[model samples]
Target: MKSEYLRITGGTPLEGTVRAAGAKNAITKLLV
Candidate 1:
């Protein structure tokens, strides 16, 4: 299977309170 990736963009400093939901069954790696 072909690999799929995500593109994210933002310009603000992340502050306080982060909520992550779903995406536990993915076979891709996330690089931050």
Candidate 2:
């Protein structure tokens, strides 16, 4: 299956707490 990727350009320093929730059976892989 094809997968989507993400790219980030110039941006101010990020601050504050970040949180994420993932699926129990999710597949994770690194592209490039």
Q: Which candidate is the best by TM-score?
A: 2
> At residue 16, what lDDT does model 1 achieve?
60
Error of 2 at 31 (Å): 20
Residue pairs clashing in model 1 are none
Candidate 2: misplaced stretches above 4 Å? 1-8, 22-32
lDDT of 2: 0.38
Pairs with steric clashes in candidate 2: none
Cα-based lDDT for every prediction = 0.46, 0.38
- How do all models score by TM-score? 0.24, 0.27
lDDT per residue as tens, model 1, 1-32: 96544554588664564333555334223425
Mind sharing the TM-score for model 1?
0.24
